[model samples]
Target: MPQATVMERTPFIKPNPASTQAAAVSDGSRIGFENVSVTYGALTVLHSFTLTVNPGEIVALIGPSGSGKTTALRAVAGFVRPSSGRILIGDRDVTNLAPYDRKIGMVVQNYALFPHMRVDENVAFGLRAHGASEDLIRSRVPECLSMVGMSAYAKRYPRELSGGQQQRVAIARALAPRPQVLLLDEPLSALDAQIRRSMLDELAKLHRDLPNLTVLYVTHDQSEALTLANHIGIMRDGRLQAFGDSKALFRHPPNRFAAEFLGRANLLPVSGLKPADEGMAQVRFGGIALSARNHHGLADGSDCLICIRPHDFRFSRSAAEPNSVSGTVLSVQWQGDVHNITLNIGGEALRMSCPPMTNPPGLGETVSVHFNPAEVTLVPEDGARG
Candidate 1:
């Protein structure tokens, strides 16, 4: 086995600790998995998936359990091989390369540091194996430790450190060699909320410092993907559902599943479409005419589903208005910053989130609800559900 080695310090101050200058095979740092499919016997884990990680970009793969998010990360790490397709790092074809040969840094949620070693020793483990000069290892370990804000805990053992601290050590260890790509598999899932928040900040700072490093981050947490990733690839049942900028995906999801899966949504089944003024359409939602943004793909008098985010709906007085509905308040509950109000409309329960309003309506009372036409989306009703 090839030993991991730490880098030699040249004593240069980082203008931005979030950027990296690591280069990959082709010309710069890029990871591409084209038509990548992995199968185990008769079962296929990944299917004809194509993804690219541009240099210095952070892309997150998010999905539910058994969605193959981790499988994709492992494929890039060389921990698993594709039955077909190509895996390229920079300009190099590394489809068959060993994991250690790829020079990629990997951090899992477990923070798998060596139990017997101190923080500094664990960070230096890779460098020592790669036969780095003792002087280089000695000087680089502290630098890497400081990079993760774990320099003060160098003397502590893995058992002595908190989950977040141990995770930082793991990150420092992976980064010791200055790899071209960093793959994180739910790295914050194990930490408490406060620590996770801090670690997220540190990770974001690191991204700003490493300008040339490509990152492939896998997580099931939507908030993590939304906050940390420049782009996101949503996965479901071992297939890519949608991939694009985080804002774009959240603002205009391609389908109902994408909308509901990415965040809380009120997906209302529809029956027809009619022209409404002002670049909007009067969508015939079952027994209701709702004004919505124009959805070119939804033909006139065609059945579809309207996806409205819970946060987009607002409560109003019980009165008929365009793009509004009247319903009996089913229940209301306090959720710290907001109130989750459930409304019974046409025998269906619709949930909406609103800021804690003064003198909220009582349950069993009829109330009016309004949603912005621009925020209401139209998707094919038949195939909207998975």
Candidate 2:
């Protein structure tokens, strides 16, 4: 068995005396799941998941449905005990602790606000339940609401507020007790696109204000994960498929699932993988030879997939350009800022994005697309998931 590597807990920083909001922020907690697994009867929902969330860092767990993101969050909250392994919070083993003892706050998708309660009472619920003094609850309730910019609406009922406002109240309620960690489960999923964007900005501002607040955000929205999280954990089929810094993970995915899941990827089937100069390889696809950066030790003539992002391809008129391929435009869809162009190369369909300011090729027009060798990624053919 591999030895468990424990991370050193970060020391708590004192709040700045000049900022009143800093007094309401709790010392961030380091969370770790060591070889954890969750099961219900004969079904295993999470398989040997291991991850460590650094103190004061935001980590987002993202995947499709049944990927065990919520299950992992529940384990951290002590709502679901791991069938094996251990969970830790700031050096304390909390795997067997009750939910209320974990010292973590959670805001769910539906906002979960009490319909009959005013915003102030809703925010005070946690503190009151924790047996806080009446004076402390009164002070903490307004402080929390103020932190979320909801102090003006403290007397309004949940039904009287908009979706975004209610969500702000819910977040205030979660943070009222000053828990060490905050778990958000699709908190912005119910809002419209515009509201969601605005709320994302609000959440970012909140993080800035509460610099010591550790967050574990769960969502299937890749854009949200990319926008908010410092680290991203990609889950699939009860396992953590990929985990690392968000930008690095998206740029250099380890497998096909991650490459496709993080963002758009054009998986071009290629063969004849041979080493070229400058850490590059020569690959042949559809009778056209292309150069790609080769990190994987692919044997000569081995079948593989060349992964490229749609934005990496540039429209060209010359077939003589390096890594150039000619294809006929099949369809064009204009997005608000860019145009999505579909092309038929040989018999395979490929998607590319072009700037709206530049007119894309018309349907049935033959055009050449050029890609740089540095932008190509080589992966084994079998790395693709079903």
Candidate 3:
């Protein structure tokens, strides 16, 4: 776990539901968790969880299992009562509302479609539960199925379709009621890798089609989060470790845990920090005066870490990249399209990923990797101490 840093740069637009949901609709389409917490007996499962899912935006809560990401989703679904604080859909307080009262569409990992019912029937069930008219059910069911590209499978039973098809039906069922809020809990985890990738594309397309739909997506897969979410919240041990726009969070991680979890990061111990040109800062790393973005604003001469992605370390230098590190080639591996090289620099291991090279440094050979200062980011080394 890492010491937390508040990361949202812009205020999230709020949630809004259908006009029929007078009890749930307030202003816009958004979800707000106000210091919500959940505890069972002596153990706390969620700790003051708070975040906003803006209108038409997808926010993914990603972390290792048991980190309370699912618990946070359930709280919004009204399946878990918060021990304190409030939950709101739009401006309406939903903390005390029943699950049925919230105009929310939910898709879970298991696909939750009725095995005995046809795809069309499953999609109509939600509409019926809300007491919609027969005409509306007939039209909405087909529209939702079509939205998920499952219109052709309307008459097929859940067992008759493939895993991907079943998941599509589940999504259609969730979307049938025209809910403004969509909660997805690892919705693509049941499918194979190929199907999962396809579903990610489908989901992105679905969101584009329904621009006003706000989504709260929970997953343990970081890649899924990065591919689908506009903003990502990294959680650990029942707390949010970091949150920001996907690219900014990945490009400039705030702490050690976030840096390593969101993507590949090569962190090196550094101190003697001092301001450099423009927004960059300088630090000392094994006699190398490295320059990087001091994201945490760590003071001068303070111990911190600089994070460099493996792909950012270049095999050759240019005029723009003045920082270079020399090391002994410990391992060189050709991983299909790229080469993964492990270097030993002053007893510390530094990894570099480069495009397929015609000539790679052999084992025990001295080599140097150059990186631009703009590609380096400083992170607070307050967590991930292993």
Candidate 4:
């Protein structure tokens, strides 16, 4: 596990597991955005953002900075008013609601805990803000703290806690108010690698404990999204570029951006697109035939890019495979358990990975690499899918 990335360590986070679903409290607290668009003066920040987070589902919105992922989350929290359209929690419209009235809990990157407040007080703040009975706050504060495994730290102040502990307390505070929806905006971004890894598990457990708590998570970390979310929404330039079940979206990205942004990928230009048997399509890359899924049902003879993840490419000892291709080795990097390979395929750069190569091919040496047709998927060159 020394060199393992989050993706390598965790399976795609499943939708609410059976045990959690059975314990879930039914509330129709689904999160919805209907053509929600936000503008500041002349600049449009979010463009007609529309997506649904089902009750008990964790949906992550991910993208580069200024892509409106946070804007979309804030809109749901009632912090940023939409210039057009509406936002809803369950079936109740909350576009015009006050932040305190939205029944949405938000955890930010900074933790945002009151420095002078003890952990218990911080957890109690939300309930008080919502005008809960003192008895409710007393019981809820301890219950939420226990749920996050922070009941022992209830007497400690934020300054006395580590970053990871502070984040736990933050999450506890968010859950204290019995919110129908929780918005986590880069909640683990501030932690180091080790702590972030553990926090990811903590979050997954938290969702299981409170399965009815709908979540809209905004993050730039693809692995975190893939590890914690049942559904993922990839944003780009203030638009929802792609949204689907997490595993499906990663395996069949709708465009070049989604393909590259979701993971490390080699996009090779291909032409001569044609249908093959069993729902497959063929494209030619530098005179070499490549077959893959036609996710978009692209028209015949159209040009598009074939996306191959680094790990999907395997070194070929023989050219017996139908999907075999030759590449000139550019460089090979030994990164613990895996070999990172840079290759020249028809003059374009492609990257691949393999088990540690004890005697890696020398730079400029010709090498053969092959991939499964099922492992490769197509992305439209111009970012559109027909």
Off by over 4 Å in 2: 1-28, 295-301
**lDDT leader:** 4
User: By summed lDDT, which 10 consecutive residues of candidate 2 come out lowest?
Assistant: 4-13
Q: Compared with the true structure, what per-residue lDDT tens digits does model 4 show for residues 1-386?
A: 01101112111112222211111234657998999888877788888888989989999999999999998887777767788888988778988776765666789999988898999999887666655677777888889999898999999999999999999999998877666788999999999999999999999999998877889999999999999999999998899999999999999988888888997878888999999987799999877888998888888999998889999988887999868999898888998999898999899889988899679899989989899999778878886421
Model 1, residue 306: distance off in Å is 1.3
How would you encode candidate 1's per-residue C-alpha lDDT over 1-386 as one tens digit per residue?
12111123211112222333322323346889898887877777788899998988899999989888898888878777778888888878887777766768899999888899999999987776565677878888999998889889999999998898999999999888677788999999988899988988999988877666688999988988888899999998778988989987887777766888888877777776876676577766566778777554567777767778888887764456457888899999997899999998777788989899787889999988888788776766654464
Q: lDDT at 84 for candidate 4?
A: 86
Each candidate's root-mean-square deviation in Å?
A: 6.4, 6.0, 6.2, 8.9
Pairs in clash, predicted candidate 2: none
TM-score of 4: 0.91
lDDT of 1 at 247: 86
Error of 1 at 265 (Å): 0.8
| lDDT values, one for every candidate | 0.80, 0.83, 0.83, 0.84
List where candidate 4 sits over 4 angstroms from the true fold.
1-25, 384-386
lDDT of 3 by residue, 1-386 (tens): 22222223211112223322222322456899999888876677789988988888999999888889998988888777788888988878988776776778888999877888998999988777666777877888889999999988889899999999888888888887777688999998889999999999999999999877889999988899999999999998899999999999999998888888888778899988998777789999978888998767788888899899999988655334478778899999998899999999878888899889998889999877788888788988789642
Off by over 4 Å in 3: 1-27, 317-321
What is the Cα-based lDDT of residue 336 in candidate 2?
Answer: 87
